[model samples]
Target: MLTFDIENFPGYPQGIGGPEMMVQLREQAERFGLEVHDKNVEKVDVSNRPFSKSGLKEKNISLRP
Candidate 1:
């Protein structure tokens, strides 16, 4: 939900709309086996190997690719 346009993002040549670009990026991530969460992250811990994520929508999310 960005309120403006993006002018410097790669591969766009001219430019891209913020919301449209966000959707495209999300789709691209999903194609690569990413579990996309459209919720706010409440907590995160990256001191260990397998990272930790905590939030109201979900918890114990793995940051490993």
Candidate 2:
């Protein structure tokens, strides 16, 4: 994804690169307490509340619906 360029992104009138946009988006999301991961999700256990999510680097997680 970082190997390409964006010519007309909304915030950057001139445009932004893929990697730059990724970093910008991450920083913005982290400011609101969101965790970012680059690994593929192997499993998800939503059968119970306050989850026992699997295959992620951060194994301890709580998810609610």
Would you estimate the TM-scores of all the predictions? 0.76, 0.61
State the lDDT of candidate 1 residue by residue for 1-65, as single tens digits. Answer: 65578889789999989999889989998998888767888887889868878888575677763
lDDT tens readout by residue for model 2, 1-65 = 65578997677888778998888888998999887656666677878876655665656555544
Clashes of 1: 0
Q: CA lDDT of 52 in candidate 1?
A: 79
Each model's lDDT: 0.81, 0.73
Best candidate according to TM-score:
1
Estimate the TM-score for candidate 2: 0.61
Report how far residue 59 has shifted in candidate 1, in Å: 3.7
How much lDDT does candidate 2 score?
0.73
Model 1 segments more than 4 A misplaced: 1-3
